[model samples]
Target: MNNEKVTVTLELNKDEARALAQFVKRTSHSDCEDKATSQNEAYLMMDGVNAVMKSLAEEGISPR
Candidate 1:
């Protein structure tokens, strides 16, 4: 297999999406520095992604 990176898309319901949005806002405000908006938004997005992955791992879940 090639070492190329692939993007993974997430599909969340309305409630889930809303919760993630809230989480991002909260985390970004507390964890991010006084940097550019783009950097802060990226940090928020990665926070959400890490949260989902961690949740799945805790539940012994797989993407298969």
Candidate 2:
């Protein structure tokens, strides 16, 4: 068995990026039946989004 990781490149326009960010932000703030689990997942998702956006910004590929 092998465990490995791969990198993916996503090409999104400014509007699409903005929309995705907004969606992630909203998800991070939303509630559900499984509050703890759902919120954890949302926060993790938000963190991933932030990390990617930060990396892109560092590379001068920001939406703004």
Candidate 3:
């Protein structure tokens, strides 16, 4: 596994940011593992979130 920094910038309101932060915290806490597993889980979550955003966009909901 490669240890690198990937930056993601989202334009979200305070509520959205808080919600996302809570979601991430909950997911991360659900498992106890090393840093690699934690990072992989985070990536998987971001991927899922991106897919949802794309689907929403296709349904005419602008992601931005």
> Top lDDT: which candidate number?
2
For model 1, what is the C-alpha lDDT against the true structure?
0.55
Global lDDT for candidate 3? 0.52
lDDT tens digits, residue span 1-60, model 2:
233555778888877767665554444434332354676666655656676667566555
Q: Residue 2: error of model 1 in Å? A: 40
Ranking by lDDT: 2, 1, 3
Tens digits of per-residue lDDT for model 1, 4-37: 6556667776567566655643554335545436
Clashes of 1: 0
lDDT of each: 0.55, 0.58, 0.52
Cα-based TM-score, every candidate: 0.39, 0.45, 0.42
Candidate 1 is scored at a TM of 0.39
lDDT of 2 at 28: 41
Task: Show where candidate 3 strays beyond 4 Å.
Answer: 1-37
What are the per-residue Cα lDDT tens digits for candidate 3 across 1-64? 5556576555766567555554544444234233336766766656655654554454444423
Candidate 2 stretches greater than 4 Å from native: 1-37
